[model samples]
Target: MYTREETIRRMNGLGRAGAPFFFVISHDLEHNLLFERKDGGQGRSAAFSLPLGERGGLRDCPPLPEQIRFDPVPCPLSRYAAAFSSVRAHLLRGDSYLLNLCVATPVKTNLTLPHLFRFARAPYRMLLGPDASVSGVHGRACACFSPEPFVRVRGREIATFPMKGTADAATPEARRWLEEDEKENRESATIVDLMRNDLSMVASRVRVKRYRYISPVETRGGTILQCSSEICGALPENWPSRLGEIMMALLPAGSVTGAPKEATCRAIAEAEDMERGFYTGIFGFFNGRDLDSAVAIRFMEEDGANLVYKSGGGITVMSRMEEEYREAIAKVYVPFDL
Candidate 1:
């Protein structure tokens, strides 16, 4: 584990030198992975950025063979419902305004980690470790196919897109329901407010650039509509020199952690009863000037011989246990090209 000061110094030095690098910051900010971009760096650390609708840099990484089958086995509804009830009870008692409750579902697949990496469909995807393994300090191998951006920095502008609502587009009324859903609207607004406050810490002129935009994501199960909002801010003149400090102030992304962050996170720990490790963490690349990153959702990690998929949704006082449980399970499928 690296000290906060050490992490700050390293990132600032690298950013100031105009060196290219990649970093993985965990949910709790207790564990971090940093690697220089040359020769893929050293040890069990690997990082790459693949934009949506493009497969250019993946020449060396071949796609999965057609013969390989993929099957995901999500957690049983009874168990998930029990956890959902616990979170709702906390909400009823005024413990937290909202919480992003998550669970790990075991998946059965014939393909390996490298094969999954080559075929996973998402705008922001990353795999870390040697031999395409995800095993790091925690001795677990994992990969992320996330559609949520933790933050992005370009010159003096900093922006973040917080995604909160989801619905199966196969339903004829999906669009209308998502746009009209009072619960989803409130959840998105809370996160947007939280993100605006976060940006105000090191940035000036923070504002919500976009609100309640629907983005359609095609997955193997079906097309799912996601609700997101864009928030932007202007950074200080010496932002690059304080990259580490800036990130620390906005850590554990507000969308995943919920409003009134600290208390919500504590409640999540008590409710989850499991280690998040790198599941909801943030990973991205820095080219000395511009930086891009994503929240580590839609994640799968290797635990011994089995693969576990981690997925979750936002919970509020208005949340229903049955719907929340279904949303968590519905997110377990991979978004393969259809």
Candidate 2:
């Protein structure tokens, strides 16, 4: 565990020395962990599928259970409505243009975090905390399987893919609908604009490479459509030296926190009961030259005897309470194969 400044200094050193390492930073930027890529994760925690490379020398991927049992009990409707109401009130009051509201729902699953990580179908995944396994059940505590890429840096170019809207794939014309919906479009466009500005702070010639692109995400429960856009910028020649500083400039991710990042985050604290912890935080792997990372959505954590899945969606002035609540609940499912 390292303080923010200490973490930055260490990352600066690693990047400057062209050392490959994995890192996890908490949502509030309070706790940071860095693992050298040499020796296949000497640190207590293990991470793999880091977008840029794989974490080697891990236990073999286990086969899925014959009968995988997973059931998530959504947050109570009244409670979600109250939270939604609070966020809506903020939107109406014009304190912020958009605010992301989230909730923690209790989930029952036969599998543990490590096994869950193995079965996760996400592009980016991480497993951390105390040692745990099926028979041991000591509880590892934190597990993340994210489909959203926070940002990727290759050479002197930096790019970000911000996922905004989600729709039930079972719905007819969901792809077209998500692409055309006013609220969803507004949310995606706002995040895209916000990210462009974020990148512009550290890079030059920022631009939108793609807008409102749709991708399908499959989970054990069902498939859903995700809307995203790609934004790019040109990094300085010495970006490797300032890698940590660049990341520090663009964090707590705009997709999860919403526009006018600082104020919206404060409003989020007032609306959502549970602290986001590392759930929406950004994690990345710096492999000497290039960097890749993901926003910690599609995430879960262990709470005592209970397994809590934290999820949520963006809220804007056009957002409807019922739909937003439904979206949050829909996001609670595990990103596992059907």
Candidate 3:
């Protein structure tokens, strides 16, 4: 178990807190990786481009056999809703600043840690070398390993894209669904606005660089569409010193926590009925100069004899109980056919 102090030290040690910005690191397996921005310290760290001939280090570890499989275990949404509501009420009352709410779905899987890691995919198609690991119960399952998001920081331009909603888009109009889904659009807009406001805390000229954008991500299950918004702002020349503090102002990520950020986070915490741990925490490599990180989502963890996939969506006053409940469970999939 990682203590809060230990986690904080490691996070700060990665140089994400302060100036030489130019590296990428995953917070943990099954999490997102953070990349330094292009203008990162005058290109001291260039974007990590995969070599055309460079195949990821998947060969070092062969893929899992076809016969490998396991039964499924599920958790109830009413329990999670109750937990979310509890936290929501407290946050609404102004008891906490920001809270990261999470729920664990105990599941069974036959694949080993490495096998599961190889199954997930993203926009960057990470050059998976040996930098992967998993944690979970022995006979149950493991949290698929992953790093953080790819971030680019330059001068006063700080931008972030947080992925929020997910849906099975087997239809030819896959892009249409991502763009038109009412729930998805509503959730994305809330987060985009929240992030813009967050940047305003440390930056000027805050704006939405991009609106509801669709990124076609290839997962193990085929292709799952994810919607995101890009928000940016101009920081002061002395931003390096205050980078950590600025980020802290945007804790638990707006995407995971509904608008009226504080209130929503509390509700999520109480409704989920479980601690999020590092699930939705931001992670990545940042060396003072500029920092880039990804909101930890689409994550799984090891808990006793079961592999718990932690997932949820943003909730608003307009959110229906049944829809929100289904949304939370809908995120539990591995995004692959296996």
TM-score of every candidate relative to the true structure: 0.93, 0.94, 0.69
lDDT of each: 0.81, 0.83, 0.53
Candidate 2 has what TM-score?
0.94
Per-residue lDDT of 23 in model 3: 25
Report the number of clashing residue pairs per model. 3, 0, 48
Name the top TM-score candidate.
2
lDDT of 1 by residue, 46-79 (tens): 5456442222244576666676566778777788
Q: What's the C-alpha lDDT at position 229 in model 1?
A: 95
Off by over 4 Å in 3: 1-62, 68-71, 77-102, 123-151, 171-174, 287-290, 335-338
Candidate 1 displacement at residue 285 in angstroms: 0.9
Residue range 1-338, candidate 3, lDDT tens digits: 23333433444444444533322222222232333333433322122222121122344546767775544455666676676566556655765333334567766776544455455553222222222321221222333332224234666688777666666566687688778877667667766777777778868888888787776655554666677777877877765555445555556566656566655554564456565645665444454555545555666655655566776665544456566666566566554544
User: Highest lDDT, which number?
Assistant: 2
Candidate 2 residue-wise lDDT, 258-295, digit = tens: 98898888889998898787789888898998999999
Q: Number of clashing pairs, model 3?
A: 48
